[model samples]
Target: MQKKIFAYIMSVLLITLIISGIFTVQTIEKQHFSNMEEKLVSASYILSQVLSEDIQADNIEHIKAVLSKVSRELNVRITLIDRQGTVLGETSYDPSLMENHLKRPEIQKALKGSVGKEIRFSSTMKLDFMYIAQPIYRDDYIAGVIRLSTPMKEIKGLMKSINGNLLLALIPGLFLSLLLVYRISISITSPIKEIKNAAVDITLGKLDPSINITSRDEIGELAKAIDFMAASLRDKINSIRDKNTRMEAILSSVVNGIIAVDSNENILFINPIAQKMLNIDEGDIAGKHLLQVIRNNKIDNMIKGILENKSFEENEISLNYPTQKIFRLNSNAIKYPESDRIIGIIIIIQDITEIKKLEKMRSDFVANVSHELKTPLTSIKGFVETLKAGAIEDQAAAVRFLNIIEDEADRLNRLISDILSLSELENRKGKTRYEIINTADKIREIISLLQNQAVHKNIDLIVKVEADVRMLHGDPDQFKQMLINLVDNAVKYTPEGGKVQVTAYNTKNEVVIRIKDNGIGIPKEHIPRLFERFYRVDKARSRNVGGTGLGLAIVKHIIMQFQGKIDVVSEVGQGTEFILSIPRET
Candidate 1:
């Protein structure tokens, strides 16, 4: 910028200097030429007066002598020409060797009775000359032409001296102009450079308010404008930053995952949920192609379709890489507010994995419930029908069949009771009665209640509790029910003469209870589904033991309500241990 300004100023100065110099030289040269023409014309008139009588007498010697002396005095050439276009006398050359002077422009003009003047190159002298010609008259008739011509070398020498002076004068002018232009350039570009740097800083997200330019010129005005613009920009940027922060907060807090892409398919933004869902790094995924981050064809194609058609689209896509999850993608084209021109796409992704699992569980639960109820009801109905068909006539047979019917009814009652208990635990929501539960007393009560069954199976039920086993805060009845279910399951699963142990203790934040048993131990793979409703390791053994296959499921629901966790460790041919860690406060 500085260089450009300097060059521009210097160019104008140089042009101005050149024009001034040319005009000055031309004026001086023209004045010199006019003065020279006057001197030649005056000299010619005096010479013509002195040579008029000689030329009328045709005295060539006298005429040539007078012309030579006058030419020597004036440093000019003198010529005499007759009316017949013959050179009669000359000072610089022999009169006979000169070209015809009558046809010369100045001579012709003089013959027509006017003072003639011309500048021409003389062929004989091989120099430029300014000529002034006057016609001499004898008795009111033109006798001859008297001409005076001065060589232009003198004028050229004077002009050369003036041009040399001009060049010498221009040297200081150019140097001074250089200095002035440099100062001007600095004055102009310095502030502009500062503004440019400030603008650069602004682009880099640095807003500096102190751009101090003190000049009062146009450049200063520009600086002021830039300062104003920077201030406005700072405010705008701050506003935008605050808005972006709020937008990010809203997006982050939303349960659904969100992604926004531009028309070019580059990712504009991905919320935290989306980043986690797609297993993408927030820093790495921005401005990246959609497929580069997600690599899900269905979502990418859905977004593309919406972008192309300027319409809303939705799809359920399953991803298996990060985790097996089902996501419902609701996408719509983001368009200009005033028109339907699509600019980008916004996709709201809902993670439906848990919802789908719950749906399937509900369906299976209904089916299992119906099957379980039908099995016992069918058997009871068959036996009653049998008894009604005349089996009552045999008293022993009737007693045996009635006993079977009663047992089946008892089993059906237990199943229904367990089912109702599980449903109640699930539907309890947050309506739980809080009370202190003594872990040791609850275990004792559960053991006494299940004592007969344990003895019948010849199984030893042992309770080992820490003296400081903290009292838990929860619904006391729910706590007792959970303890009973765990203890019963332990006793029911242990083989005859095998051992079942219930341990309760306290941790930093939880009341830990462990039920361990030595029995036909479950396989490692079945532990995950052990708490599922109606899930049995050995169905025949379970039914023979009069188990409803819902005790653990009920225990699971109770533990969930207490905001506790349960884990199982088991190996085939080895013992199984169920560890329940319930928070002490709930």
Candidate 2:
């Protein structure tokens, strides 16, 4: 701005100086010419009066002598021409070489009895001249013409001096004008520069409202307005920051994973839960494309569908990387507050693998229970129908059928009892009454009870209990029932002359019980579902051994009630072992 103002000032000054110098030179030139013309005319008239007698006589010596004296006095060239336009003599040039002056403008005018003046270039002298001519008269008849000429060098010298003076005069004025213009420019632009700097700080989020322009001009008013605006903007920014903090807290506290994205599928907000569920540890993934952040194509498609439909969408998405997880993905489009335009999307994920597994278990339990109950009922119905059709007439046949009916009823009763017991243990939630009982003693009692079965099959049964595991806290009946199930299963599965071993000991704050048998071992695939209700590795063999298939499941539930864990190790054609770990304190 200063430079622009100064340039304007200099331009105007230069133009003004140029015009003034031109006018001054022209005026001086015109005035000098006018003065010279007057001098020439007066000199010519005076010389004509003195030289007319000489000219009438045609006395060339006298005319030349007089012309020389007058020309020296006046410092001008004097030419004398006769009526016939012949130059007799001249002060400077040779008369023989001089041209006739008959057709000269000044001479022709002077011949007509009028004073004539002309400024022209003289070919003889090669100089500019101001010429004034007057007619010389003798007895009222024109005898000759007297013309006075002065060279233009004197006027030009005066003009150069005048222009020099003008330049000298303008130098100071130009410098002073430039100085004043610079001051004015500073006064105007200083405050603007300060305001510009303050605005830059505000853009960078430094909202300091200090501008030191104290004048009451428009610039000052602008500074005050900017200060007020900065205050308001700072308040708004702080309010927005507070709102974001609260929103982040709410998102972090939620149990479900939440993801928010923009219309272009760029991630805007992703909570820690979402990060964990997605197995991502890269911090600050916001503003990245959704596919770049989350690598699952199914979830990406679900988000796309929700955004395209601008409605809600729910899907069960399975993730195989990191770990296998089943997520119930619920997605919906976010819209403007009062308009139907879609903004982005909001997605929530809830893990539902456990819930699905429970549903499947319940469904399988219902089918197994129905099948287990129907088998015995069908057998009893068939036997009774046979007896009612006169099969009771034979005492031997009647006794055999009665015994079969009794055994079937007992098996049905055992199955029903085990099922009921399992249900009760499963539904039991809190701690039950637990008394500290001798661990070795409990194992001895259970083994003795199952010893008869082991002997019936001619299988060797061994019992081993650690001396240090004297007592553990649990329901003694449940503990005894749990051990009976394990030992009985081992004995029943072992072939004749096979060995079954039961061991109990203390391991790290828990009582460890293991039942091992050398028999046809369970297959690897069946171990995961071994404790499920009515799940059998060999259906026919279990039925033949009078097994209801609920014993292991019931034992598992009892151990769970005692806050214990059960594991099995088995190999085909080698052996099988069931290991139980129960807390010793409770």
Candidate 3:
């Protein structure tokens, strides 16, 4: 994150440096050239004025003498051109070989009574030259022009040296500028860190905000802002603490544990439930290694993976023996610019032990019931074929065999129906029809369907529903089927005179459905396994009752399909109650 800001800064600074460098170099060059031009014209003007009279009278030798004097004195070559563009006299060039000069733009301007100059390359001298032209006037009228030409190569060489020095200046200037910017950035950030540390200390200590930084710029203003923010945070944090007392009480009332950590695999905070589970009691264990406190390697690895890579997921891993603590670690990272450093990470740990138990039991029960169902179907098919070969002609034997065959077929049909229902409920990942449903009405329908069976068993099927419940969202058929499965399971387990109650209600966060039975309660040891696909407290009795054993398993899965939570409380030989909580649509 810091690199992003650094790249942006570098780009802006580089552009500014290049633009300013070009402007500065050009300005210096232009001023130096102007000064050199003015000096050349001034010096040549003196020679033109001194030799004006002699030149108009056609004293060519005297013109050459003046030319030589100017040439030697100013390190320049002099040439005198007449009004007709012919060379009258020249200091260095052989007079016999000279050409016309009046046609030149500078020479014409000079003959017109003005100073003229041109910088060009000279073929004879083989160098870049600056020519200064001035008219030699006898009576302030037209006359020949006195022109002095000098190579500007020397000036160009001087400019090159100046450019080298400017370039050198750029290096040192840029270095200092960058250094200043870096120091300013650090100076600005340093106080922010102090304020941050103080705020953190205030939070950990549950005390007042205290920050210290001295400056008198925008950074100083920001330091003041930090001080104000810290004070505000302290007050708000206190307010939160007060409000959280009730929240803490509510969370503590729950049996599940909660653990929240930082990206560094350090235990940053924990709730009461988590504290109880971990058995930690100290002044402050906030910044300690999780592995040092948590011995469970599986959970440690999960937490590390999630915190490092933001891998939020579900898994069943043991936290302690005799008490299995399953957790769903939902985690994410926070990236903040820290001046060329890395971002931060956080992990949230939620105990899903009860939900995990339900899932596992549901799995195991399905497997067992499928085995049971296959066995009977296989036996019936084998027996029917054995009788068909030899007993077909015997009327008495055939009649008895036909009755058994019909009964077995009915059993197979019933088994198939159960399997279909279970599969439909369990396969939540598969597509299914869902719609808005009156959960209360759906409950009544399921109870009515199961009422006759309850009556046959001399069981009282009672229902309590909130009539004022608004319409809800779900697969109504699936919901009804799940309700029938749960109630049927309850009746099957209950004694003849026991009562079964189906209740539905709503809270602020969710709609709840509960099936309670005063029946042969599940043994504490077997309760955890009850929801497994074919898991049974009494395998023999479940088989005798012709149960596929997938009833509760199907119920559990259907509840989950609608994004709900379930829990069962049971006591051996007493009673069992299954509670399902479904979140309300927002």
Q: Rate the local accuracy (lDDT) of all candidates.
A: 0.86, 0.86, 0.75
| Per-residue lDDT of model 2, residues 1-586, tens digit only | 7678667777877788789878887988888878888888888888889888886787878888889999999888888888878887678788779888898898899999999888788988899877898999998998889888888876787778887887798789778877887888787788888899999999999997579988888888999999999999999999999999999999999999999899999998899998989888868899999999888898888887777776685789888888778899888777899998778888898888788878989998999899889998999999999999999998999999999999999999988888887887777654566788788988898888888988899999999888888477778888888888888888888788999998888877898989999988999999988888888999998998988789998888888877889999988888899999888863
Q: For this target, which candidate reaches the highest TM-score against the unseen true structure?
A: 1
* lDDT digits (tens) for residues 17-95 of candidate 3: 8898788878887888887777778877887777877866777677677778778887778887778888877777775
Q: What lDDT tens digits, residue by residue, belong to model 1 across residues 1-586?
A: 8999889988998899889889999999999888998899888888778877887788889888888999899888888888887998888788788878767899999888788899899887899888899988876888889989988887899899999998998898889889989998998888888888877887887776568897898877877887888888889989999999999999899989998899989999889898888788657678889998878787778777777777686689898977899999888777789998777888899999999999999999999889888888899899899999999899999999999999999989999989898888778877888888887788788888888989998999888989878887788888888888877787877778999988988888998999899877788778889889999989888988888689889888888878899988887767888899989853
| Model 1 lDDT, full chain set | 0.86
Off by over 4 Å in 3: 1-370, 389-404, 414-427, 430-432, 584-586
Q: What are the clashing pairs of model 2?
A: none
Candidate 2: count the clashes. Answer: 0
Residue 211 lDDT, candidate 3, scale 0-100 = 59
Give the TM-score ranking, best first: 1, 2, 3
What residue pairs are clashing in model 1? none
Candidate 1 vs candidate 3: which has greater TM-score? 1
Provide the lDDT at 359 for model 2: 90
RMSD of each: 7.0, 7.0, 25.6
Off by over 4 Å in 2: 9-194, 197-216, 260-326
TM-score of predicted structure 1: 0.71
